[model samples]
Target chain A: MSVEPLDPSTLPEHDNLPGNAHAYCVRLTGPLFVQTGRMIAHYPAGGGTIRFEPLTATSLGTLVAERFSSPLYSRDWVVANGQGHVLLGDRGYDINSYDLDEGNLTVRAANLLAFDAGLELKESIVPGFLTLIGTGRFLASSSGPVIFVEPPVRVDPEALVGWADCPAPALHFDAGWMGHFLGAARGALFGTRSGEERQYDFTGAGTVLLQSSERLREDPHALRRLEGEVRQLGPGALQQLQAVVQQQLAEHQQQQR
Target chain B: MSWRLRTPRVLVVDLDGSRGSAVRARTGSMVACEGEVSFKDAGIGGGGGLRAALKQRVAGESLPLMEVSGRGSVHLAVEAGHVLLLELAGEVLRVESESLLCLSEGLRTDVAFTGLRGASSGQGLFTTSVTGHGRVALLSLGGPPIALRVTPRTPLVVDPDAYVGCLGEVRQSFVTDVSWRAVVGESSGEAFSLRFEGSGTVFVQPEERR
Candidate 1:
């Protein structure tokens, strides 16, 4: 049998759909910043309309410039303005809303679904994270319900969703792996990896968010970040990068063939 | 003798070799069975006759079905998608062909034009409409299906990729935010959304169709 159909009046203001953790509903009273392609559906209030405007929209320039400070993510976000109940789902992941009261949080860029206009967003020092500063609510999704762990914890890079009130995590390579890598011969370039040699070491106050699953969805922003960093290389470095890319492409083609 | 859900994703239909107990299910959806059973092709039009077949071919909403009849219980599943069972009481169910898993013997399937709305969502310009009184099992990808209610006062706008189908009386139209930036190829992903007005119930999945 089908579940009871939810209307705007019955829908929660900011919560996951009843009996379903993957879908979220947001009652849009003011402008909300949402990631591209995350909105699944929306119900408009009578006599009002909702518009999803890109960050570059002139009408939203002042609000966006004041709240959004990440140029690398400008193309990946939009401003949803109007009166309505907006529905958002991300790859069937479990979505949860977090409230910040004059606090700050840094989330993996890909896991972030949407945030409030009052929250100031900045790119974290970490390459693939965004920090939200101020008092507001934000939505994020993970492969499963997020597990909160205190600092002095080491998490797999793939399972680490984000951290709150914690300093930037340090890259921790397994001691055995480091020793083996340094002791191995040159031909070991094709190193055998268990995919667990790297971890994020959290060693300060605050909580860390971890998903139950270690499966990572491909993040388009990660590729864009890499492309952005490529421009900083000198000519010699660029040539070496080109050679490396070609080698990787040749190996991929060989494997496919 | 009866239809039972083995799980939210698995459907078990029992047949007693009676004409009334037979079922038409999507081809290749049979994952397991017990006792003696026989499977026969449901033909090109999915047992809706030649007109339905022709319309389906033109609309690109073809459903390849196989009729199962025998003294045995059969298990049905597709693509590991979540299955939802809906019983029709003379009301119409408009659904995507790919999402239809199985139908009891008394239902009739036809094609209905969905206009330019499908072009953007990649679901095609037509949807499969099921009428009559029977049980229908629908499949949803990614996660559990979400049902939303619509009224004259509260119209629903949806991303086409997340739309599964609708029940009762509902009218759908294409909504596009056509600005100069769209022409310049810098438009947001929400450039095209589907608006549903009138009174009815709409179903969407937790993930968009890629």
Candidate 2:
């Protein structure tokens, strides 16, 4: 079937093309905070020019400093100012928009695509994640369709996309050390691919987002966090840490073969 | 336009066994055939003669093509990518050599120097140009390609990594705001992008090329 080429007038408003999870068209009336390089095209309905100003140096610098509270993401974001229809897509991942009514939602930093300026962005306590607060719309991308599940459960660390309106999750172990030891004694020993050893334990109340695909993008924020953490070490301790990292790197390279 | 999609990833072309017209496809792209068919390499520079072949070799934009003839339904795919069928009416299509899947008999394919953006964008310094009337099918790494309308008044700035191709009379220039981009560190990926101006259509994929 031949699909008609979509221009500004024919584009969808605040929605995605039917059955298309990879691209989203937003009828931008006001300014929108978008991740760097996510805006593929913008069609101005009023024929006004749309300018993307870096969040750190925009004319709306004061406003950006207030709404955007994370320094790590300051360079990675830009404010789409002016009138136009902006189309966004993220590496062929499925994108979904969520509306929060004065609630809080946190998502992996790389997956958070765009958010309304009405929402305040903050660095989540968890590394590699960002939290959005206030009543507004936000967009996030996942490797696959996100599955929503209630808390009071444990989720695979790689599969966990984010959590909404909930307390932070803690590392959960299988709690069967004795059983594992007995299995080892019976020759069913270590690393048989049960995938049951570790998980993120989510209790209290709220929703957890899970992605069917476990593929992950390299986390830049996590690296920054690690770099920031290393600043607290002494020179001697730093050298020792480097030695450990080198040993780990060597072991990893060997495993790849 | 008469072609049918065997799947989202595979395009099926039914050739008229008696016609002199032929379909030139990417080399080694023929996956299946249902009727009498013959496959032959389209030779140096994908049937564009010696000059074009030399230009392609010098420019480093290689378009390896094989001519598919005879009648039958043929299944074609490239790396499980999505296929987009485009109908061109005498517009110059400047596309990366890697994305050009197949071209009709009447189309002319040549290698053209596209300037320095190719080296920075990773799409090569030279692009394949397809002109004349016919169908052109393109392959993309992710989702359907976005066809953007560019006018003189509304110039478009696009990340070079996501750009697939463009059709019509357009001038593409490299634009990079170094003042802000320098602060983004080494991993920004796209410190330089392409700015297109003029009347025509620009195609971009959802994913940035790695």
Candidate 3:
């Protein structure tokens, strides 16, 4: 609900973080620290909301350590080997995996609320917490909560629509089966069976939000057709198309917020 | 006692006191009944006519003949009933309870049974047919009939079993070739796709069984 604001001058250092985008800095003043893409920073002593400007690439390490240690630092937790872990608020805990090689530690928060890449974190009404990491797309949803962490993986967005937190299920179908049903030679191109890909079904009370690369490939023909339709339309039709696109963009923006 | 006519595509029956009845049409003829009659068929070619028999059946009187048209017709005797007639036209499926029958000759016809799940449910027998061309009218249980328009640029795909009508303006193609082994493979039952290209409309129901 309400969070304490942080002063940027006292903020720790971080490098290679996005500039121009708003950030939040929490000071832990210890060897171990963490940085996140969310706003509401929490610690055992107290938690508050803070905003930070983007940091230069050189300061990234200090910034990450401060953010990571801020929560545990207040709890009187000792930093060993440049790493600290802490229970995140009353609802969840954070397992800060600090990778020195990457110069960033992944703060995996569980059972709190909502998180976004814009350094804004909101309390979740549904019994759940938010987790922020360095990679993947920002996910926001109300469906369920089960964050399946398979880094360096890409998935289809449309296919990922209902799946928020679980590993993608194994898809089964042979080329012969595909040829018979679609009257085509190969089945690998088109997925077989309508509802067989249920491996990504996230089971929990909250929503699972995922950013997937596979989304770009879903219904390629449909997108192409829509684009062509927009292109072929005259000035009047173009105006209508533009209006629809604007509406969709606005909806996406709202969801991010 | 009931007499079902598989040949000549017609069925003649007498309802003693049963709740259900059956009928078949031969030579594209239509039959009108007083009570609700369940229609099923092995298969019937399209186009025909059906009219109510004016004379009622008595104890020992001459058997009344209903004016029937088309290739085949089926008549079911029921107690205290409402008349429901079904017709199959090419590209259009129509059901009319109060209209006269003058179906075309290009459509195909069949009969099947359906059931609804949940409370207050029972098996319902109904006549389902497919038409190639022309418009088929269906009498709704309530409310006014809703008209949906489909055009060349906008083609609609529907389940073949639930297809109520079509404009016959498009072409149908299979998504894949038909082969015995292919059917057993992953694609199997889903392999055959009725591809509709060109301008036209295909009517479909929400639920379709593969």
Candidate 4:
């Protein structure tokens, strides 16, 4: 309950606020890539300014092209430049910073708060996650404290945050559930999912990141990714997808009723 | 009698009827009360009379308050938010109307213009200002409030959604530069941030207002 106000000089570089786990303070010397809207506050250096410019800004075109490689996430990230201490938060999640010295790590896009410009960011082939390569530090948030686990494990899709030095996980379906789905009576194939029947199986040598809670945060980039994938569908496939969406809308309306 | 924090989210006000002790609190914030206590509306103007009422109407910074008095202690809370108690010693405490939970009888609440800075923060154009010597309770959303110290050398910039309030001599203004441009498809969410100069303390919450 004792809150000693912190100034730039006293604030830690890349650490959670004292007595608070939901907010983090980062001392900025050069440029840092930050997720849009995650910045809570910042203290500029004496007579200095910390400018938050979009990745699309012309002044940052060359720098962004060099450090940032994810097109789907360009709109969701900004380049923070100048000298100062910046505080970042994400919906009150637990914030943690990880340093990668000539290593790589992949993390969920929505959970990543910011990363140093020294690291290069690339789009992970596994869809909603982004891969950070080279070296430097990055900040990410989780619904609860992150739990580290070795490979040769299975994790709930909703609880899986990201994995490091591991191959993308393969979708694993419970044997009993698969038997039920493959049975002659396929009527319950889509409607009778208990949600626990599916998990991500990791068999390689690497570490997996998992949140204590199974609650999932709504990802803003998910829709855009789906939109990008839709461009590859044929005309007939597009019509069938529309019909499926209409059916989903009808079912959703019925549930509301 | 004064304010005692029962928990981070709960506040209890000890009142003595014989001493004519009373407090003005946000309407619908009382959770429980012991002994003989009564609640009364703080009138149309929220205690500052006709002029304040007109300003509140125009500024959309309406504060609906209720006066609590009697022989017992009253428990107060709102939206399950964390409570921050402050002892005001005559310095003006400018805060959001919605964040105000309780105020001592001696303090006065009024509306003040905050210019375009408030507009981008989604706090409208006016903010509620409290003055006088008394106890004040503020409600912070998401988590415990963080107090940042500002001086002549270091200026602070804050996202409007995360800003709670400020005390002392601080000047707030909106900065809309090329960096404030909205992305191609997305709204960029943080189009601008409130910049504070001079020497003062600024308070911010851990979570932004959605």
The prediction achieving the highest TM-score against the true structure is 1
Per-residue lDDT over B28-75 for candidate 2, one digit per residue giving the tens place of the 0 to 100 score: 888898888889999988998899999987887888999988977788
Q: Model 4, residue B93: what's the lDDT?
A: 87
lDDT of 2 by residue, A171-253 (tens): 87675854676657555655544675778899988999998875566776777788889999999999999998999899899
DockQ of each: 0.60, 0.41, 0.01, 0.66
Better model by DockQ: candidate 1 vs candidate 2: 1
The global C-alpha lDDT for each of the candidates, from Candidate 1 onward, is 0.86, 0.80, 0.29, 0.85
TM-score of chain A of 3: 0.23
Ranking by lDDT: 1, 4, 2, 3
Q: Write the per-residue lDDT of candidate 3 for residues A96-146, one digit (tens) a residue.
A: 111122121112122121221223222221111222334322322211222
TM-score of each: 0.94, 0.87, 0.22, 0.92
The list of candidate 4 runs beyond 4 A from truth reads A214-217, A252-257, B18-20, B117-121
Pick by DockQ: which candidate is best? 4
Residue A137, candidate 2: Cα error in Å is: 1.7
> For every model in order, what is the iRMS?
2.3, 2.8, 27.8, 1.5
- DockQ, prediction 3: 0.01
lDDT of 2 at A94: 88
Kindly list the per-residue Cα lDDT of model 4 for residues A53-154, writing each as its tens digit: 888874677888999998888888889988889999988788999989988898988889999988999998877889999889999988889999999999
Is 1 or 3 the stronger prediction by lDDT?
1
Candidate 2 residue runs with Cα over 4 Å from true position: A44-48, A176-196, A234-240, A250-257, B16-21, B114-125, B152-155, B178-180, B183-185
On residues A53-120, what C-alpha lDDT tens digit does candidate 1 reach at each position?
88877378998999999988888788888898999998888999999999999998888999999899
